[model samples]
Target: MLPFRFIHAADLHLDSPFAGMSGLTDRVRKHLQQSTFIALDRMVQLAVREKVDFVVISGDVYDSSNTSLRAQLRFMEALEMLDREHIPVFIIHGNHDPLDSPRLAVTLPPLVHVFGPVPESVTVVRRRDGQEVSVITGMSYLTSKVKENISLRYNKKAGASELFHIGLLHANVDGNQEHETYAPCSKKDLNTAGYHYWALGHIHSRRTLQESPYIVYPGNIQGRNIRETGPKGCYLVDVDETGAVAMDFRELDTVRWFDMEVSIGDCRHPEDLRLNVERLLTDISESYTTGFSMVRIRITGRGSIHRELEDGFILEDLLIDLRRKVDNQAGTVGFAGCVWVESFCLSSGAEIQLETLLQEDSFIGELLRLAETELAGDIGSDSVIGHALRPLMDQPEIRLLLTGSTREEQREWLRRAMELTALLLLDDQEAGGASA
Candidate 1:
């Protein structure tokens, strides 16, 4: 068997809308709206450039349960491009786009092979002499909710050691908490399946469970939310004549998502703080080249300007000004890209010398010590503060804004409380000194 290569891509989520974002400019929104399709085009371009023997899309090619005509047409168009190059595309429908879906009726080109609900095997041959290159075994989702361990259904046929066997599946292995446990199976179950490689989907984070047999998830082609941060794309895999497989990741995301933290701990004035943030934004903008960059800047750490930031109007104005400065259009410099601040979260505290203040043995020091003691111990959910917070935390929106979701979060909440108390006491002392 001669060495051959193929592209393994999954979770395309075609025509998917960006989530958890609002107040987007017309141009940015339009660019993001078309990003998924752009990523698909990039994937096709990559496969053609790499001159892979074939392409395998593990699952979720479309975002909707009832697939849109536009998505169907665009998908067909991409496949047609590969078809023109005499490249074959193997696909398995995932939970998002099950075989039972009432999608737009469109006939795929002959080069495209879609797996059905039942397990099937395909022998891909060399285009030149029709010599068998590999055997691909796969199954598609018939319904959206398939809780059964579908790995149980796949059994490797005896014989044919020379032919490389690849298993294409759209499943949640060993119960990934991030997504529903559809077509769930254990790592051991897949390892025992006897295939050389398992191309998996469902979870949109790339991971390799085992290296020897290569049980892998290629993640998604594009990121559609803040949660799906970083470079998103597919894997280019090569299987040698000796059956040694090598995998390389190729980034295809048109729009990138990032969570950036800018500390204002040293800034003494508003202008200094603004410059600090601007420098950070500039640095981030220069880093990404693909298209647009969406960033959520978390302004954190103790600073002199914390009091001013606590005033709602001030933070709002700063956000408006920062957006204009960062997201403004820059001419095509390739890597120099447009960066938009999706949201600004102020987690910074007021700058105060806590240890010196605590040495004074005052009421403020007592308050600080008390908070420290409480934080050192259990949060005491049965106590007065916790009881008061229970009702407020029950509301989803309020809980989202609240920090204390877990024990670690409770500690952070206590820390922030101590900082706030210390700041307020210092301000009171300053006011008294001025009056005297």
Candidate 2:
């Protein structure tokens, strides 16, 4: 039997809105819309090129229940491309797009097979060489949340003749702090399931659980925002006749994610920051295919140039100019355009002073202690306060005051505002003395 090779991917989040974005140019926003679809098309193309035995999409085919009809149709069309190549596609719906009412009604490609909500079994796919290959057994989430552990549903053992046994699941194994604990299970739970490979989903970052059984999360095909940065893509698994699995990560995202931290510690002027940004972008452009890549530049560090970086309009203009240059030079070769700057924040070295306050006996220090006590007592309420005061705390003028203000003024207005704001918002009066 020919050994089985398959492509595993999840969390497509198709047509999801870029909710936390601002300052994106019209062109960039347009490109973001096509990103998921582009990545899906790329996945199908990769599958066709590789001539894999089958493709398994663990879960999350769409972004939400309110996904657009256009997105649904486009997705099916991409699947049809795989169908044309005679490649069978297996999919399971996750919490985001459960197999129920309200989702876009559409027909899947003939070659596509979707697992139902309940756990079920599928026979091992064999090769023409007469060897029994892998058996893929899986289940989808019926509702938005499956509170109970679902690993028990996949407890069946694989047949002896099968070279590999795979379990496809949409779950948050253990308790991932960054994600909801849906379908929680332990590594031991999956190991006991007796599967050679466990393809998992829900968490957006790529991860490898246990190599012996090969449990993994391939991450999302395309990143939707700054939080989901880095190279987003799928995993290619090559299984040998002895059930030895070799895996490699393949970049399927047409739009690459970049979260670059540009330090301005030595920058003497705003132009210096501008030039530094240009240098960084130029360096990135050199290494990547321009139009197809996206970059989020964050300006960091304490420097004299921090004050000048305060003008959002001017900084944005500089970024736009840089993007224009990059786009003009390399837009056609599938480079979408120039870099898209997400956000810029400035900090003054006030944190050191704040740290000292935590151990002091001064009035400000005592107030800071009290705030911390309150914060510990009820974190959720204090979080709301922090969110409300974040604008004032983040203001460039306020950050500059921490250093530039005279001793008398610092002891009066500056220190008082800091302490009061920290107590009321951050639940830590010590933050007023914190370095920006």
Top candidate on lDDT is 1
lDDT of 1 by residue, 338-392 (tens): 7777887777887788777767678988878777777777756675456657888
TM agreement with the true structure for every prediction = 0.88, 0.79
Instruction: Name the 10 consecutive residues with the lowest summed lDDT in model 2.
Output: 344-353
CA shift of 11, model 2, Å: 0.9
| C-alpha lDDT (0 to 100) for residue 161 of candidate 2 | 44
Reference-based lDDT, residue 259, model 2: 81
Total clashing residue pairs per candidate? 0, 13
Query: In terms of TM-score, which candidate is strongest?
Result: 1
* Alpha-carbon shift of residue 258 in model 2 (angstroms): 1.9
The TM-score between candidate 1 and the true structure equals 0.88
* Whole-model lDDT, model 2: 0.75
